[model samples]
Target: SLRQDHEVVGVRAGLEEETLGGGGSSQFYDLNVYLNELLCIARLLDQPFQQHFRLLSSSLSSPALVLPGPPKSLARCRAKAQVDYRGMRYPSSAHLLDVVRTTWVVQDEESLLEALELLLASQIPLSSPPSSPLRSSSSPTPSSPSGHTVVRVKNGFRRRGGYRDVKINVVFSSPSGFRVIG
Candidate 1:
């Protein structure tokens, strides 16, 4: 009976290995696929056998590691602009500063949100935003007579590991200020 049990365990391991090792990029990509396969294998064994195999499988699998990419250049540009326009200047300089300030603030806030999302999703710490471009629709026009402009910003986070991380769809109805709908 002991010899029979060992043979069964060996056979089960072989089958699991074959299923897991089939041609693919990585097992982490489709967790559901492996999980379904695991469930089928579990059903073939008794309670005690199932527990043993579960431990073996758990030991064999590792959590996926996602490496963060280099810090974004936009943040640096924003900082430099802020420093360069720190002092009061001619009327035209002030106007230019106002434009730059508004644009920079919006971009900075967006970057903050993206960073937060990445930290939550990947369990990786990123000191700066990813290099991916921010998506913004054409300047909003008055959809209603209320003098409000409806703008849409669609942004997504893509990891350096070739996995598309998150898609953020935000809509803002303004003139009274920005309100995010997502």
Candidate 2:
């Protein structure tokens, strides 16, 4: 069995290695779960993950597109936008949180907001503290937050169509320098 299998498990694991933190999808690492904890820490809190984004969109409703567990990197060649320091074609933030994760956090749910504020308090600007109260679902913010910038977004869930929930966008700047949220 050993000689027959050319690709050993150990070698494969090395390619998809990730810190104790969530895989670098930046959903949780990117909020991939980073929001649940590390709100009290002082210094920049960040986790390293390696994953290739496959058509990063506002909502990944298509059950067809399954998330690559263990975090995998794409080996395709693509142009990196350098004008305003745009890293890769794929965005690293504001994918919106899946309801399943929050167990459908709805009205009278301020815990999520409070938790987010605490997580991003250090990097928050005096004017805005990343506390985006749940707004009228009728009107969702058109665009979401950018990776480099952590401006609070007015939209979190879709009010119409397949989307129906809305919440504040969370931003966490890691020690190595990267923003991830839910």
Candidate 3:
């Protein structure tokens, strides 16, 4: 595949046999450049020769977009940013636990339900000394079906219309009482 370009040029000039059989595209060019940059960074850092030697021994592969960031920045924004930094250190030390993931903000009821399901799935059960005590619904409620357990999170929690950053909550459990009441 890399020889396609060579083949075309060779046919036009009547020197098909002498061409190096190289078919380099724009992507191939970009990949070569990216690899060169990566190699240069690794070399300048004074990493062991064997480490650089390994990458040199293998064929170079192209990536769509390769943006490297620092590990400390990544750790701080771990909750918000989804980054694959391979392994690099930053120049600063900062605690960044509270970075909110923009994707978590839901605009509609359908997305709200989806987000609630995802959140509920991630929650661990309350321990013996419960942080918040659970209470049963006074009478029949729409959100909780007859057979299922329910704890009213807060009154007047509407799904539709304009949204705010109110913390809406719900929990569901099995009949055998592997329950998650929040």
lDDT of each: 0.25, 0.25, 0.26
lDDT of 1: 0.25
User: How do these models rank on lDDT, best leading?
Assistant: 3, 2, 1
- List ranges where model 2 is wrong by over 4 Å: 1-108, 124-149, 152-154, 157-173, 176-182
| Best by the lDDT measure | 3
Question: Per-residue alpha-carbon lDDT of model 2 for 50-93, expressed as tens digits?
Answer: 11122222123321232322211111101111222134222221
Residue 82 error, candidate 1, Å: 41
Candidates 1 and 2 compared by TM-score, better number = 2
Listed in order, each prediction's TM-score against the native is 0.14, 0.24, 0.20
What tens-digit string does per-residue lDDT give for candidate 3 at 74-179? 2233322223322222201111111111113345656556544544444444322211111233421222121211223332355655644434322322222222
Error in Å for residue 143 of model 3: 32
Off by over 4 Å in 1: 1-25, 28-30, 47-182
Model 3: ten consecutive residues of lowest lDDT: 2-11
- In model 3, what lDDT does residue 39 have? 25
Model 3: residues with Cα > 4 Å off, grouped in runs: 1-104, 130-152, 155-166, 169-182
After TM-score superposition, the amount by which residue 90's alpha carbon in candidate 2 deviates from its true location, in angstroms, is: 13
Question: TM-score rank, highest first?
Answer: 2, 3, 1
Predicted model with the maximum TM-score? 2
